[model samples]
Target: MANTWNGSDDPVTRIHRQCRWSTSTLQMTDLESDTTSECTNRWIHIRHLPSQFNIDLLANCSEYPLFDDFCPYLPNHGLGQKTHNRSHSWYRTDSHMLELIFHRRMLEYPCLTSDPDAADAIYLPYYAGIDSIRYLYGPDVNSSFEHGLDLFQFLRHYDSSHIWGKHNGHDHFVVMARPAWDFSQPLSNDPPIWGTSFLELPEFYNLTALTLESRAWPWQEQAIPYPTSFHPPNMALLDSWVSRVRRSRRTTLMLFAGGGGVSASPNIRRSIRLECENSTSTSIGNSGYSKLCDFVDCSNGICEHDPIRFMRPMLQSSFCLQPPGDTPTRRSTFDGIVAGCIPVFFEDQAAKSQYGWHLPEEQYGEFSVFIQKEDVVFKGVRILDVLTSIPRARVRRMRESVLELIPRVMYRKHGSSLGLRNKNDAFDIAIEGTLQRIKSRLAEISVR
Candidate 1:
């Protein structure tokens, strides 16, 4: 202080001193730590930037890098002609598929994973199944990478565990570089004790690859609807409903919602032949007709919601024949109940699993006939006998109940009674609701 100039001193000298001091301080700050210059040309460093923006810029600048990093492309894969805004085959649009878009992106943003045991998140195969074709396109094994050239982001595709292994480098995501299901290998590639995706634990919070199911098993694990386990469309009348569709037109028609079409046995295969439409009889194959109301592969599969063209005849028919696909307890069986047409369960082990929550077994037993698969026969039984015997009054009520079911699955006009299918949306409303509940539960638990 004794050596410093007083207030009357020269402004030039003071200004120079201040400038030098400020410049030294700025240089010190610049040299304090690393910057983007230090990470130049590193892809991993680049990827980390979006997540590693400094605290000062994080509040707003952070989201931009991630949004920019995501796939900047649109899919043009012609799924099918658009109908109901869906791929005409499935229930939604190409944008909803997101399969192609997700696949191409992983190539550019491959997650680095050195260990397969790291638990970070689930690699769900979006929909579910092990189709054979994608295997040729990509590798079908664990302990190996498919050269990772195929474009399927589904955790179920090439990876065997469905337990997406996280890149040890990032705490936020399970960097999955491979599909979880490969057909070329044995089924035991992933054993449950170890490989089962245990995401409910502390791992699955932030994710880089994700898809969600629109519906799920109602949580009371012990609470399965007998003959089926379904949450009726939310729009359905909450009151107990029991009804059957009244058959119109004197003409005979039989619709098979999910017949033994794809995995059809020689006998069940032969049975569709005996059934007739408008006095016209034809075999399931070569007759140029299909027996499926809808042939569903997983939404994860190549065919989404593509109703088997053969199923169209069933829709037009007075009676729809529904049996479970590979498994019995399914959404389709309920669809039939709600459709009001009689169902022939072709009773199997699956029928036993469900307590038969909605089937009118106690009252309208005659409406739904359950014949043993083995007895389906050689009996050469014709469907006409069942329809002729059922009372018209009972049929009308079934139809009423069926119509009631559709609106529950369909979206509504917000404040109106009229309903509609879920227009294309990736942010599944139901999934979001579940996540919100989970988050709330976590918050509540944390407080405790």
Candidate 2:
């Protein structure tokens, strides 16, 4: 469509050029010394790829599966259709549009350097999420590697300037909106199974990749927050949302809004649904247990159509049940945070081990509750009992903490300038974390 970067004399270009660092005697200490200066100065270099990798993929949205129309989500630079007639800023953002959202935000990133030689990190704006979706459920799963291999071959040309050769791409990073496991397929499978073998390729071993749900083991992947429906235009709108949720009159003790399609035996969701029904049945005259739980049966998939149907329960409940979906992570974890509801996770892989860059590891217990999946499924422990056992004072503290974490998990509206006090969003945190990680690696190589 259009050139991704503006002209050389454009405001964004001029801003970066004015603060571009001199690489003649750049030291590791200089990069690590000042965090605020690092954020304001030019450090990241965005690679210019052809439209086929990103913009053209959006143009061909109609070619995707007819059953699930993704065209509505492709507009407004992947922010999706706006929530019409709403006073607050909101959109029907697809969780898989992280690549699109990150790219749009990067266009406005102040720390971007047009000069590759002086950059600390290079961002590959490849939309692997959209590219791999067609291959995921199709019959020709074997052909899934073609587009990734092509992208790898295109980067081989960058070796002429030693861009890819410098430290073997340890300074390079890519955002894959899908789960890390979706691209971690084995090469030796007899009959081709689910997912592409993109991450398994030898060329990407040293690359620092970002995904929504990273694998638990030590690897190149890091987890970033999934895109939720709320994309506040500025800090004022964001603060308004936080205030409204904080002041909400929560009458329900816990809430669960999901489908019961899991056929696996000892299903934790089935147990949760059973407990919710039991709580509703015995609420006639029991003052202590009346209105103890709220349930929204998503088996018919109505929650996916209406955002209010999904988020209202979270706003009105003390705790939101976040059981594992097809994978360990669910978008609802971030959604609950946006609603100022304390998320009760069933597995460590859901949040604790996943989002090290965004969520604090030691402070996880302050905002969320962790109950083992086996305790609910195998031991027949009731969810209402466990949640009710938590003291009211501690629950209030946890909800306050969850409200404070709203900005870190959210992706702000593209090109919208934030107020001075409230600056860093999800994109800012990911870029900062990536740059620091690259700087650390370069320091190790310098001492070697």
Candidate 3:
């Protein structure tokens, strides 16, 4: 039987005092307090961009053409099979979900205020990403440009008192799932390229842009992670998944799941495939539609379509390869993290340069591996050899770190489908980061 102390100053009391010190929740530091305030206290004024720009785009999602770029390395098109698909809503397009999830999360945010006067930051929730994709695949070549032109005209006519009067919209921000390159045209006075000319507008330069990938320009575009499949309903589900990932045995040293047909110029996928095939210890799963090659130790060459298929290998592998696809950023980075798989990247911009708020600052090597693009494609460095060299203890530490990030990286489901509860997820982090940035920008402007 456990011994009971006779007095308040007995051994039991001392043990309780020690346990309190060890297990009690730590008080929020100054940094954490500021972060929480930026997320919940800062009033954000969301602009009413045309329904055609955001709402209508999703309403007509069924008509969206099959985009090979959306899935990237993954070959299968549909979200999950309807018969076996979970209760949650799913989509085939990979990059488009960021806008949808952001919209929902923002609407549900307690700090979202319609009154522009009370706002510290202005949110121009434009559905530019999906609209860009529509025009890219649509019959009309100039449809995207016209869409941007129309949006510009609307904002131009909007009461300047509502936005422009407040430091000329310096606090205004827009979240686009596409990279900045899509909207930003080259300075050669070139014809409209992939995206709209919205960013080119003078007023747009003042507003900040939260995008999947930021450009090299000196403007205010911030890089954010592309949406992944795992949107856990609550923190409990997320914790459970993290525990599972931590408990799972990692047999494969490294895993690369992607398609080969996406890029033609400096076909990194082909090089990766060759290296993975040549290396005996590595596991390679072809994520493309064409079942041309048999996947090493996988059921089929294609597992991109199945969310479970995509996540299983990642969860079971010690390292997940995340090479650039379509753009410098890949959704697989987020997917790998949720599965507690260490991401091995060929490009620095994908996650290292991007996701400064969501990911740890100045510590890319802690949770991820960076192999230079030239080294992988040109120098012929074997991924397996590079990964296997990492000490087992270090690998365990990195995996644990990544498992901690799962909650922060995820988009917690909101509303009746998932119930109403406040949980800090990717959206919270992005909002807080943007608000803090706006505050800093305002300070800089004042100082200048």
- Winning candidate number (TM-score): 2
Write candidate 2's Cα lDDT for 52-151 as tens digits: 6776665545454533556667656677777676635788788777888887777666666656677789888888878887677544466765538777
Clashing pairs in 3: 73-259, 75-287
Task: Give all TM-scores, in the order shown.
Answer: 0.39, 0.87, 0.77
TM match of model 3 to true structure: 0.77
CA shift of 151, model 2, Å: 1.0
lDDT of each: 0.31, 0.76, 0.64
Candidate 2 regions with alpha-carbon error over 4 angstroms: 1-42, 138-140, 158-161, 261-264, 281-290, 446-448
Better of 1 and 2 by lDDT: 2
Model 2, C-alpha of 44: deviation from truth (Å): 0.3
CA RMSD of each candidate after superposition: 19.8, 5.8, 14.3
Instruction: Score residue 156 of candidate 3 by CA lDDT.
Output: 62
Model 2: residue 435 alpha-carbon error in angstroms: 1.1
Candidates sorted on TM-score, descending: 2, 3, 1
